[model samples]
Target: MRIFNEFTFEAAHHLPHIFPDGHINTRLHGHSFRVRVTLEGKPDGKTGLISDLGTVKAAFDSAHEKLDHRYLNEVDGLETPTLENISMWLWRHFARSLSGLAQVGVYRDTCGEGCEYAGEYEIERKAA
Candidate 1:
């Protein structure tokens, strides 16, 4: 079974690296962001549940507090604030808090854009 929880935040950011002197994305702007964390696990024998919904939500409490109403550029490790980076940042911080963490998603509803990511692994491939 799988479970997920989400939270929203309002923050400002700019894509300073995008070229063109007056490119709109290069300008500082605010967005309402929705972040989701997904976990995979089997239902427990006693409770017959994957995990408690409240616990899943609470696991993201630190993330909500850090991202809400802050300038993304100023946040440590979020200087760029792209959707992909945001999802990765959430995964890095909240992975340990919520067991079975499988994926993360970040969305900007107003812009109809989003990104989803599964955590990376250091794969060691054998030569044929």
Candidate 2:
């Protein structure tokens, strides 16, 4: 069975390397970032559910609190704070607590600009 949850947070960031030539991103900016977490595993026979929705929500809420209404560039490990990096950071944050964590999708907004991270193995392969 596979279960998914969605979360949203607002944060400010600036990509200094994206467009250094007087681009708008060079200055501080904010976005309503959305994230989706997917978990894959066999449902427990007793509960018939992959996981409890409230439990998952609590986990996401705890993590999102760190990002919400904050400056992404000031967050540790988020100095660059691109969509890709943010997704990866989220994956790492939840992997240990969420069993069978499969993927994390991070979006800048509703316009479909975002990135998805599968796991550390896949990320390592891409780097290689």
RMSD of 2: 3.2
Pairs in clash, predicted candidate 1: none
True lDDT of residue 14, candidate 1: 90
Off by over 4 Å in 2: 121-128
lDDT of 1: 0.84
Give the Cα lDDT of each candidate: 0.84, 0.84
Error of 1 at 3 (Å): 1.2
Can you write out model 1's per-residue Cα lDDT over 18-114, one digit (the tens) per residue? 5577899899899999988788999899999887878778877888888999999999988778887888888888777778888898999999999
Q: What TM-score does each of the candidates earn? A: 0.89, 0.88
Backbone clashes, each candidate: 0, 0
What is the lDDT, from 0 to 100, of the residue 83 in candidate 2?
A: 85
